[model samples]
Target: MVLNYLFRRKPEYRTRKLLCFSKEQMYEVVADIENYSSFLPFCTQSNIVDQNQSELKVKLEIGFPPIKEKYTSLVTMNKPNLILAKSCDGELFEYLETVWKFTSVPQGDPMTCIVDFSIKFKFKSNLYTHVASVFFGKLVKCLETAFINEAVRRYGRSSTCIFEMTSQD
Candidate 1:
């Protein structure tokens, strides 16, 4: 009982499926840091303070109910393959990291790709952590759906296959 509660407050790992989109297309959607607020959940604003071929400095404002926070992060991208973002400074979080990995489907199986998305974060405030723990699973699902919906909106859906699993799976 105690362990369950403790574990819920720590970093979480999740894997989901994405189908029909090429690796490059999926990469473009995730790497477009400045447009995140338009699709991402609770993201009120996003700005690219600096950007280059390999890295981007971005700030995002997210809010849920009465809580609102802004944080800056440096996102490093490796073309149409991998993207990683880490929080540089944030009052509400101790650490926040998210990774997106895209792998093309085997040839002859249609032009599809598998997107592996994972996020780990810890809040600095115990009160906030407690509040978040109750909704973490749902929050992750919303984020995943947001990305997929955005992809369909932009690239048009060809095939769709989405499944969710935790580290336990």
Candidate 2:
């Protein structure tokens, strides 16, 4: 299905750079991240309709204030390397694509989960997309913090999972 009618046309998006963990380790993290809404606090509902060792179909309910938002997506787990997912068939965004990559360089005991991700999201031609992109930074921070906290919560401080952003400068 198409996420939005905008996709009736073609779409375009771009990714920036990345930091943390070796490529292998990053890939592991990406694979695990497919079920991220499962752990993210802001997410109210995450229904994994189907799954395998490396893929998922999730129905997600995310909190954003005015109203709760729901989106169902088919995510492919490009393990130990990349996890790319797009808007299911009929959804909000006209077009959407997110790519996540992991890279790691031995960092002593704990392995850094350096993640490089790009999101190309377009709306039905309006300011909504612009507004969302503007606030996306904060949302990403929330995700990062929650992700790190969850790592500690699950793996404990002794575990080797470092979720830190690398400097682009």
Candidate 3:
């Protein structure tokens, strides 16, 4: 039990935010996996290995100081609504999944959307999991901010009101 507590399994992190961009705008930002390295935190490289109408296989390299890893993921796109990516490399991660959901804000401006983002992951090495757990929350927050900043850069601010949903860990 102590070991389990120390090296947690499949920790999931989630956050939702109301943004000043339309659902289509947000979806485009999230679905463009090949551009992740340009703006995403810790992403060193992003390359699309394969791509079709509804999906993409991408290889990503992420590094933070001494901890660097490269992995491939299968990204499934549901267009203007959902983008889900699952890790394909078992050597680095036992499992890793990221989900993004975009919906129009109810009773809000047509140019606004509610973005729900979640990531679930477990490292193959217990030591890595323990190390990553310490920085997981902050890392996820940074990632969220990166996307928001990118959206603002691309589309400009549609509204001044930005709502943050309570985070779920």
Candidate 4:
């Protein structure tokens, strides 16, 4: 079993709600590619290769301790609702994908949003995997918090919010 652990790859995923923030507000925070470095941990650089009305092609350089990786991705969005990203030409990851879905709070209640964020990735090298495992939890929390922080920075503090990891894979 220990030997299998060395070769096995695992996917990480989490879903949480960001209450008191509108769907549009939460969606905007996730879709903004250029401002990632300023708020996202380990995001050293971000570049937009191309963009259109519906999609964006971007490259991001992320460094986590001993590992630094650069990857390009194609991002598409369905306005205030969903954001999808797929890894493009990249050397570090075998596969990397992220999905974000924002749902509005029920009518007659405070304007709130439920942000569901998930990521699935596999590094080409096992060494990267081991290193990532050490920082995985921190990495995930940082990513989620970055968006929430940005929302507060842009919008305002939310007195009502429920944040939790729905699951992991």
Q: What number of clashing residue pairs does each candidate have, in the order they appear?
A: 0, 13, 0, 0
lDDT values for all models:
0.81, 0.59, 0.87, 0.81
TM-score of each: 0.87, 0.64, 0.91, 0.89
lDDT by residue (tens digit), candidate 4, 1-169 = 8645854756576676656788888888898889999999889899999999999999999996786789999999899899999998868888888989888866734467777888878787788877676677788878987888888888877554756645433
Question: Given candidate 2, what's the lDDT at residue 105?
Answer: 43
**Candidate 1 vs. true structure, TM-score:** 0.87
What's model 4's overall lDDT?
0.81
Task: State the lDDT at 14 in candidate 4.
Answer: 69
C-alpha positional error of residue 149 in candidate 2 after TM-score superposition, expressed in Å? 2.1
Query: Candidate 3 lDDT, tens digit per residue, 43-126?
Result: 999999998999899999998788788999999999899999999878789999999999997888889888899999998989
Instruction: Using TM-score, rank the candidates from best to worst.
Output: 3, 4, 1, 2
Regions of model 2 farther than 4 Å from truth: 1-38, 106-110, 125-127, 158-169
Clashes of 2: 13
Best by TM-score: 3
- Index of the highest-lDDT prediction: 3
Q: How does model 4 score by TM-score? A: 0.89
